[model samples]
Target: MLGAPGPSPAEEPPGGGAASALSGLTTRGRSFLAAGFAAAVCSYVLGQADLLRVGLLLAVLPLVCVAVLRRTRYRVAGSRRLAPARVPAASETRVHLRVDNVSRMPTGLLMLQDRVPYVLGPRPRFVLDRVEPGGRREVSYRVRSDLRGRYPLGPLQLRLTDPFGMCELTRAFSSHDTLTVVPRVEPLPPVRLSGEATGYGEGRQRSPAHAGDDDVIPRGYRHGDDLRRIHWRSTARYGELMVRREEQPQKALCTVLLDTRRSAYRGAGPDSAFEWAVSAAASVSAHMLERGFQVRLLTDTGSSVPGPDGGGGLSGGGFDGAASLDTAGLLLDTLAVVDHSAEPGLSRAYDVLRGGQEGLLVGVFGELDAEQTGVVARMRHRSGAAVAFVLDPAAWSREGPADAGESEGGLRLLRENGWTVVPVAAGASLPELWRAAGDHRAAAGAPRGGAAAGHDHERA
Candidate 1:
């Protein structure tokens, strides 16, 4: 049951409105008083005892409920918990709420509700019959959305209603939390690429020679130095404890380029082609990170996934260089709040890749025109291995022809320039579609083309 507004000491006036508007008497509360006054006047003038008694009862009934409610001071507390703190777009997440009544006296019928982001769904509400002093109650609800973003979960609203339904009071709690809805990512099929890490690490072949004249010199052993790295020859020569310092391995980096320019994609909202491109980028990042590749995520407008602490982002074309599984969550968290920019093209990404060291380049893009296709072709030459997944905006538009051939033209151009191009459709199975990409670079031979080439001309 909803209630009349009441003062909220715990909250500010919503939208900077005046405080008086926050609380007011209900229509029912006013009507009961008006009826009582009229009846009392008539009974007194007509000298009718029964009518007088009825008038008194009507006047006093609401007062009694109001007085009881006013004497009961309800001090309530609440905490909200979002399960699976991180989730993918269009997936279900559960919210758990635990409320405690810390008042000295028991609470009357209390109504509870929580505010949420519009995209996540409607505000959830519940009725608590009563809670004894120092007692608690728990409630849970589910939220599902097709949008990817970080949203705040609450500031719980509580209401107190009289048993007679004549009086009502409402209050709002000021506690809030965040929910991160990241882009949906799926597992991709196994694929092979050709590249050698240039940074540092002992690869399949061993090199006994030191890197350079400035290589790390043996010194006194440190607390954390491994005993296995102790150089007995250096220790004997120096007449003290000495250990050889190992060099960090140079791992090959895989750069995931996401096209977030507003002009590059078609449609809008959950089913937009831009959203598909983001999901593809997220999946590819996860796949590469799992394979122990240092990953870098980049977008058109220089936006990147900031670390959890909001520092140390993949800015300035530097790969994160951490190949652990834990690094995937950090990348996904950044993608959750990514929004499209007004930039016209992918020129920024192209420029950054052109000057960076050669490794692997993975491009998740939208429909490409002639000029954009050339930009991609030029960028492909700077990398040891290049793969591009292009989203066909025409396939996703209801008014456009599904068999539009621009995507095929773009794909052919990319293929001719040594880039393995894969065309993607909306709602297509990512695993099956990725597995159909037939381009592979041999260990010794040139980039070879495989036979999974039907979508080049056929409508998605």
Candidate 2:
């Protein structure tokens, strides 16, 4: 069989070597030994030499097989590879395993089994015939999970059996590999994020300090400095050949905050409000990053992506030189294993946001009490454009009807604080909600900026 059933727990050997080989005897081998002993006893009682000789041969054959198999030195190695090691939740990823036999002698029957988490699926097993010296055999299987998290796949177990099926030994490779099942990232529609235009957008205005004829900042001239670029005023002020510095446009900044306090959300499994918030955070982060925005992800505990300055929050140049795909992968990988916090409130996230300059803030929140509401409301002032997606407690859980009033009250408080609020319920369409947020910003007379129009024209 190509993919044989795994060994039963009772059939597994406890250890390797001669003792284990003897303990690994098959039913046939044990029956032969038992029958041989009985025959020998009957022959001795009847004084029959011929019967004794046949019994001895039968008994010794199984012993010889065990001794030979135990003495056989088989050097084998195993390696595992996960194609697309990082995958979105509810998606399949293939895992390939290779077994190499380095011993000079041809190997016996090989049974290969890989350990896998129950959530991902059952462990996969395969059977292969003899492999010649320096030969390798490869096998692959698919695994998937509905929930998002990190799972390990590895420590391949190989069962080597004697040609006669008289004995077997199990050996396991020590190395392991990890598979990251990230949250499903939904593609969001373009919407104007209300924020000060400090990036390379149509609405962006040069700083007043750099507006006039002396817009350039002068620096000490370097060896390759162009003489025409030298600033006369700076040269006259004790500066040796000061040349004007070339300035580069800055990228827009976006902060995505996710509420992870266990008490803030309801239900469980993949459909929980908490999970929805996580997915939303991932989608928003990816969307902003694709638009050439320096995006930072914050949770109730703290910042997930460290800034250029090595702090918990992102600095202006945090994402310098990073490709959008790489940053998106980093963000998604972080969000993949994010779980609810036992501690209450969003104080850590608030502190992280406070440390940064005014920018665009997108928050995905669950049920918030008056204290948490006030905390989040105060955060709006730090961002030029602030948008929040609040989950309806009642929709998240049938037992959470009492929290409906709290959710309504929080939304009202946020809207009064000049935040564009979108109420999210179970099964709500995120794309539609995103468009509604854009409409709300438009109705509020927020300027038409680059983020709202998409980055197509800007890229061109």
Candidate 3:
């Protein structure tokens, strides 16, 4: 069924609706033939030979016309396109159909069979009214997408037949049309992403490794000021352009560390622990980009989702697929390909990235060993990157302390080092979590509140 189907359509119409058409035709054709034959019989019985001959010739003319038309071997043609152009999940889109009759003779009936993509269309069959020769017609139909990803439309088919129902012929059209249906994505309103690492652009300002603060903009070098950045030409022109000293904008970077270990992904419905990590990453990236920071993507899964075709992504900022690709699609694709295992590949990737240039590092994960905790703690204290672990309560089968499987100890270690820590959970709102984390990172350098830290914290 995925490829072309065999069989030139049935000589007779082939569908549930075909039965009615057959019945209607049988009754009408039989009536016409019987009336014509009765008139001929009357003329012959009355011994009017010439009149009877003329009647016979007139009666059989239409049957000969149908035979001739069928032998000529003409074809039917049509085109199809999906509209609104790009279709997203849960949204309705239309399909445009334009049909044309390419034969010299008119077609009274057309049994069209259009191939729809997976799960669309009322049925596989289409019923087209009479089409005039060399004439065109267009029509539209609506369809809804229940899932995400790409869909291809193709192969228009038309079955043509002549009037009087004496003979039938089938004509199939050849053309390919395709459309991609993306996943439904919610809008991002706030700038902060929870359960993500904070680099130079949290509430507090940070300087780049390669460059220090512009330090101060001259309000206008007073006679008593240091002559380090004096603009003599400006003083000669406006008496003083008054170069205002402002805090230099720090170059910032952020990376999302996701937890794809089987042990970490456990969560109840609407509480997928993995989802918390993705949403947190999206929120953080959006927020950081708005604040003029260079953002990078990192994941904690054994093998992170690679950029399309193993190609590295563009640097610094500007929405990648984040704008064109729905957030759900982004996360779902990540989840679909995530390898559920504990691979130290994450640590190696981190080291390679850090070796290039020292910047803030945000760590996202579910389980951390003593050594892993120390590494994250050292990264925050020594390199200025904080790690936030999205904990899920549903991970452990046993019930003990409410904080039994929590990452409180590791969080505390990062906090003491002046690195901000943000925890998230399903019970809280993403916006509220962001505000709380933003406030805490601003006021206390860490938010004590939780947003999506629970292991199984699932739901969108």
Candidate 3's residue-wise lDDT over 416-447, tens digit each? 86556666554446556556655665565333
TM-score of 3: 0.53
> What TM-score does structure 1 among the candidates reach?
0.78
C-alpha lDDT of candidate 2 relative to the true structure? 0.76
Position 154, candidate 3: lDDT = 54
* C-alpha TM-scores of all predictions: 0.78, 0.86, 0.53
Summarize candidate 2's per-residue lDDT along 130-194 as a digit string, tens digits.
99988989999999999999998867788878888877667676677899999988888877655
What is candidate 1's lDDT per residue for 298-417, written digit by digit as tens? 888755444321123232212334424446777888788787888887788887777665667788887688898899899888777777888777677655644457667778889889
* Candidate 1: stretches off by over 4 Å: 1-9, 12-28, 47-57, 196-243, 306-326, 399-409, 438-460
Order of quality (lDDT):
2, 1, 3
Q: Lowest-scoring 10 consecutive residues by lDDT in candidate 1?
A: 308-317
Best by TM-score: 2
